[model samples]
Target: MGEKLKLYGFNNLTKALSFNIYDVCYAKTAREQKDYIAYIDEQYNSERLTNILTTLTDMIGAKVLNIARQDYDPQGASVTILIAEGSMLPAGETQLAHLDKSHVTVHTYPEYHPETCLATFRVDIDVATCGEITPLSTLDYLIRSFDSDIITMDYRVRGFTRDMNGRKLFLDHKVNSIQDYIEPELLRRYDAVDINVYDANIFHTKMMLKEVDLQNYLFKTDVYELPPKTRLEIMNNLRREMIEIFSGRNIY
Candidate 1:
């Protein structure tokens, strides 16, 4: 690593990472859609989300001071964890899993098309921290944590910190693109795009699966279950949905 920056005082720059991960699955029938929704809800319940956030805090060398999680009545969960730069709690001492300066939060949304049984599972996560630790440190782990078919990430550094000579530094680390933080092996599986504003200290990266396997996008249905023409139609629909989501617009 390069020599650490000589800051006159505490590094006050804040780095925030926000992510929207989408999992698109096609359910051939009404019952299949319902089952898929239930499955996603159960699989990503509050307890599981809490555990994931806890692990993220640990991976970034942060301590959790407080944790508040709730399971929605219908079909969703939300977990918010406050973290700080320090050691974890004692093994038996259970308390909030966050500190004042940092926090991690995740919320899930499961919905299906009213007409077609096209189901989508979306997870929104935000990690913001002040001081030396960066939210970028957990990017890859977060991506692999969920069933991500398309992903959009926004990373921004705010405010300024002072160096030894009282010079203001907007960014402490070097980052030309958010892709700089993603592992090349993981990147190879997706077609990625970068829209960065270098002068403003902001970076955005969007990724969509380069190749879609019909079987992977089908929930509670086998490839052989559908006739060749029908399978192709459903495949096209799923791909269209993913594209719309990735582009944040309706093209179909």
Candidate 2:
């Protein structure tokens, strides 16, 4: 018979041998010798089994070693088996197989942004649709649809915000310290634009002119009727700009 076998700890191995549970015992080759010595010292009942274990270790080209009881606990132990030379279990398959296959809809708590509407759609699809619509293509569509005066889109880091009078300001959370590279000229321009810093980490800022005058211009130009794809483009541009600014190497 091709060795009917099971893997276990030193204590179990000793017990199995003492009770003549199996014809042979095997252990990992890489385990420490000191561990094996310690295990032998601990189990008074298995003193006779030491010679057998040592012989088995040599036969299997494995070291006889001690292993703590904690190592076998639910959260502590991890078991992996190699089936053959080139074939083995898939990565993450063990955990994935144990998961219950049930649809669960997670709702956001009221404490978070109340106005934000977000949902995740889980689909087992082979390909993504995003690659089909490039960001530049989306931007081109938006620009062509909207009037220049009504919808002005520019990329900038989201940082400081100023009051209507341009005196009071708020800084973003991540901005640790103000640096000299943030030029006085830039500050002056920010003052002019009534820029207020909201979050230091969020790099991009999208400014939409929601006033009646701007809305009237958008209506007049017939650009307000742009598709959802065009709107998504504008939003994505802002996101990209933010990501770039946050990841930029320049510290100042």
Candidate 3:
């Protein structure tokens, strides 16, 4: 590790990481579709999401100051955790006022296309910090925690901090691309793209799974149960959905 630069004061640079993952599956009948949505809701409930965020807080060596979590009535859940660099909290300061800039949040959306028999579960997460810690280190863990078919991430560093001599530093670390922080093994599993603005200290990466296993995308059904032609159709539909999502455009 390079010698740590002594800062004049608290690191004012706010590094924010936001990403969303999509899990696509084929549920044949209406009943199966409903079940798939229900399954996703229960699997990623507020309690479980809170645990994930808490683990992320620990991973980044931050202390959680407060948390607000709720589960929706029909489906989905949301969790937000306010964190600080360490045990430091100003006396008599409100939790939100003191740590509003540093927090982690997650929300889930589960939906289905009855016409195409496709069920999709989407999870959106955000991690922001304003000190020596960064949220980039938790990227791999977050990706691994979910069944991700397509993923898109945005990372940005805002504001500037001063050094010991009062020199402004926009970015404390070197980051040409967000992909630089991702695990190589994980990179090999998906086709990734990067759109970065180096001058502004912003980076974006989008990934789509390279290979699709028939069994993995099926819900309460076996590949063998699908006739050869039906299997081909389902695979095509699934691929199309993923591509459309990855491209952010509807395909003809």
Candidate 4:
């Protein structure tokens, strides 16, 4: 932490944070796969997602100007909130298409392998602010809101704000790595990697949970029901899938 810069005008610097998470599941039968999707849809529907974003808005110390939410056909949901850093917008002027300051959005995908029993629930969230608010403050809370096996995050500070003396400051605060903001307890559970471009003000971090328990990945099934060999095969397939996702490439 350092001394706050005295800005001449509204802090024009824009900081954006994107958080993405993957929850893997093993649904061995056709019925199980259907149930998995159904469960995901229910757990993260439009209503619940909106509630989460509302709490996030509070966490970042921003005011919600407007919100547009929808639950898609068959599956998935989307919620977008237009926020303000200071005073609320003039009455009767609330629309997202013209918003350029602060906002929060969430998109969910309930998908499964075509030929395999592997299923994955993915949620992508973006929180961008233009004034004094910083999205990094809400990182841990957002991660804890989901059931994650793998987490990938990207944070970038864009544009510039002027100091009291009219000098342009690219970044208002100091941040060497996104990992620095993550809580120690959560950090201990995952293997992490960082690829950052400090000069450009962009930082990326990806993490994969270190421990894998078969029961956690199984859907509507138990380890005791499957033969020992089948259980081992399931565990291997799950591990391989997780590794490939964490590495962002296929394993040959």
lDDT of 2 at 32: 24
Residue-level lDDT tens digits of model 1 in 1-252? 157888996778898999999998888788999899999999999999999999998898888889999999789999999888864344566664433467899999999996656999999999998878887878789889984999999999999999988889999999999898888999888889999999999999999998888999888778998899999898888888999999989998
Q: What TM-score should be assigned to candidate 2?
A: 0.14
Q: For residue 100, give model 2's deviation from the true position in Å.
A: 73
Tens-digit per-residue lDDT, 1-252, candidate 3: 156779996778899999899999999999999999999899999999999999999999998889999999899999999898764665555443354369999999999999999999999999998888889999899999995999999999999999999999999988888888889999899999999998999999999999899999999998999899999999999999999999889985
Give the clash count for model 1.
Answer: 12
Off by over 4 Å in 4: 88-100
TM-score of each model, in listed order: 0.93, 0.14, 0.95, 0.94
In model 1, which range of ten residues has the least summed lDDT? 91-100
Compared with the true structure, all predictions reach lDDT values of: 0.88, 0.22, 0.91, 0.89
**Consecutive 10-residue window with the lowest summed lDDT within model 2:** 14-23
- Best candidate (score: lDDT): 3
* Sequence-dependent TM-score of model 4: 0.94
1-252 per-residue lDDT for model 4 (tens digits): 366778996778899999999999999987889899999999999999999999999988888889999999899999999998645455555533324568899999999985669999999999999877898988888888995999999999999989888899999999989989989998889999999999999999999999999998899788799999999898888888899998999994
Q: lDDT for model 3, on a 0 to 1 scale? A: 0.91
Would you list the rank order by lDDT, best first?
A: 3, 4, 1, 2
Order the candidates by TM-score, highest first — what do you get?
Answer: 3, 4, 1, 2
Better of 2 and 3 by TM-score: 3
